[model samples]
Target: MQTNNSVLVTQQIKTWLEQVVIGLNLCPFAKRPYKQKQVKIAISTASDDDTLLQDLLQQFKLLENTPIETTETSVLVVTNHLQDFFDYNDFLNLADALIEQYNWQGVFQIASFHPHYQFAGTTEQDPENLTNKAPYPILHILRESSLDKAVESHPDVDGIPEQNIAKMNQLTKEQITELFGYLKD
Candidate 1:
């Protein structure tokens, strides 16, 4: 399998997100519906990163009665891997699941460092389109030379530290799967 620093960074972020979700007592999917005030983040190398997405949904399902269906969802799909960089078929499948199965009507907020970045099968015409071309306000994080660069480029009123994109270029599928599963038990 291909490997590089980008993969490592992706793994780190995924692991961090999973840990945060559980640590914040947001596990067992059923609990998510009531915590409407929480600004939860779900990160992945790609939106189609099945290992991460499936685990998230399964965990959410564990605690809530809401159908595992996604609905008008607002989420940030962070990645160094852009739409053209990965398999298009996988991306489409991910979108289908989110739109049809999950009932997610909210825009999918995508944050990527790729110049050709685009969410698969998502167009500006779709109500879910939330990107550079769209008019809706978005928070996009991109690659920079350092954490300082990220901060300088993407500033916040609260003085939050800009998240440095990890170089995730050396990870195996098993490693990725293990990382994705690290938070539950």
Candidate 2:
């Protein structure tokens, strides 16, 4: 059963995906799966890393068992933990290890998003960090095959990061606040 808080959180994520991600074309490939309703949003209320990993495993299993036509991808929203960017970044190692442990390296991959997702050598205030910032910590589970297909079809797949950074740089303060208001509180 979904609680009111979970419902609200899911709605916020969906809004961000639609308005910031798709609206600004941060991810050129997101629109189709989103429009097709093949994206699964799973909320995790774990307050500790161990519990969070269990939640993550559940999502991984879900993706592993489900067919691609039914669910193309999943976003596991970690609501109660990893609020610190550094901790979240470090936790990615464990996430990657889990994939290797299961020998799912080429079968599945995880893309991370967080409320404060600063890249290496970049300060917290850098505009480019907004490219991966989200309302909450998210582990996006993607099918490796699907990604290969997307990459093969995209005309300039390697330029996506540069394009996203350029878009982030163009955002005004007001626009950033409007699009990412959840981060304010």
Best by lDDT: 2
The RMSD of every model to the true structure, in order and in angstroms, is 15.3, 0.8
Query: What's the lDDT of the predicted structure labeled candidate 1?
Result: 0.34
Candidate 2 off by > 4 Å? none
Off by over 4 Å in 1: 1-38, 45-48, 55-73, 80-90, 102-115, 118-185
Alpha carbon RMSD to native, model 1: 15.3
* Per-candidate clashes, comma-separated: 31, 0
lDDT for each residue of candidate 1 in 13-88, tens digit (9 for 90 to 100)? 4444344333322223313422542333334443436654554454333323322233212234444333443453
Candidate-wise lDDT, in order: 0.34, 0.93
Model 1 Cα shift for residue 102 (angstroms): 5.2
* lDDT by residue for model 2 (1-185), tens: 99999999999999999999899999888999999999999999999989998999998899899998889999999999999999999999999999999899999999989999999999988999998999999999999988999999999999999999999999999999999888885
* TM-scores, all models, native as reference: 0.27, 0.98
